[model samples]
Target: MTGKPIDGGAGVVSRVVDVADPADPRLDDFRDLNSVDRRPDLPSGKGLVIAEGVLVVQRMLASRFTPRALLGTDRRLTELGADLDGVDAPFYRVSAEVMAQVVGFHLNRGVLASASRAPELTVSQVLDGAATVVVLEGVNDHENLGSVFRNAAGLGVDAVVFGSGCADPLYRRAVRVSMGHALLVPFARAANWPGDLEVLRDKGFQILAMTPDPQAATLAEALPPRAGQPVAILVGAEGPGLQEHTMRASDQRVRIPMSRGTDSLNVATAAALAFYERDRLRTTVST
Candidate 1:
């Protein structure tokens, strides 16, 4: 059945089309989301960014990515409310059964939006005017990567810079785990890996590489002294931490104080602590 014009939110009318067929060509962007080879979010494949659930979909609307199409049930459409007012894409209204059939899973969130990947920002672009940024290396775990974005957004990180061996931050799973903060936070890839770190240094950012080495200065000692200065907190993967050369690139090696003889923390947790300390110190200094 063809869609009728409806008040999507406030007084604005949204282009809502009723879609009953799971095989409809327009639904292709959201089809088989769980299929390993056919997932639209594969950076190596369709290169689309998929936002699932109402909250993430709202974030996507406010982000750099403009949705190409949206597929969701009527309940979700009403839940999205005014967020759809100015969106130019068609909202493919479907039944819950059809949504599950098209996406190949029962999405409890009941809504999804598909957008083409936005152009990547350069390291300099994200770092421009930034006071604090997080640099990551070899953090291939999607959930951990997402948590870093979420923490970065909440803890006053100005940007995120990816070094070598990092996963795509826009991957659907990463975006979901980040609670959509991955879409809102500015991030850029280091085109030159450790070499690009020189860009941060040249811009006057004091790079603090995170580690568990007992000899390293604690976060309290490392952050307060640099409170008013531009800083970059560098975190590596869970087990290996930063490479020796990467650690050498930093102005300081810092560790979170631990008890019970614990050697290290999860990459995301460690990053959160570092971010919080840096923010706290900066706040204290400013106030």
Candidate 2:
């Protein structure tokens, strides 16, 4: 079941097994990955978190979630190179056609890693020492949820808080869209919406709810100095914005300035701007 070394000559430790059969029992974790009713990523199903493509697979290798196994073509294995060093997981090398047969589609990423879901962090745990965090509510779209994670990573947002009615961030589509940042970023779900906001307040966070109200404080004016304090940027779904009750729980309401006739921004875009503004203000005040 073992194949030759993919790269780096003689010292390779990865056990590469060439499996041509799609129905092979060893490949069960990757079979029928696209089946809506039986996808392995479903929390109700096998509950495994999958990282697709070389970049995400590498990110998973670095994250707390350790891969139980990998399925990829020989080309992708060579591309992964020494990143597989000490991975402690078997690499199931297969042909592209075999991979397509197993996954139920042609996955252009050419690589996949399956890992078990790690225990989720608590709200307080993710918030520890966080200078800025994004709180989301009613964002049920998987792609939007993924975009928020990507934005959070790129814009220096410290953590994410899921209020209610949000999509599972670890869903395969969401994880792929986030470029694996969904796995790297710390996040937690609030046990109680709006009420748990009080906990953030008690922790010295200035909660600013992002809304389309032109009358609200501008993003620049909303973010306060964040030296010894923290800020929570709250956003709801795109069209609905923040719920009335959720908005009322915040310390203040904030809006992004827009051109005339434009009153709203996509939820994730708005959150990124808030994160960027907060980081900008923190840098300015610190300097």
Best by lDDT: 1
Best by TM-score: 1
Worst-scoring 10-residue span by lDDT in model 2? 1-10
lDDT of 2 by residue, 1-287 (tens): 12334663335736888898899989888889889989999999999999999899988988989999999998888888878888888899999999999999999999999999999998999999888899999999999999999999988888999998999999999999899999999999999987899879888888989888889999877675444568898999998888999999998899888899776777788888888887764443331
The Cα local distance difference test for each model comes to 0.91, 0.88
Under the 3 Å rule for N, CA and C atoms, how many clashes does model 2 have?
Answer: 0
Angstrom error of the Cα, residue 92, model 1: value is: 0.3
Rate residue 218 of model 1 by lDDT. 98
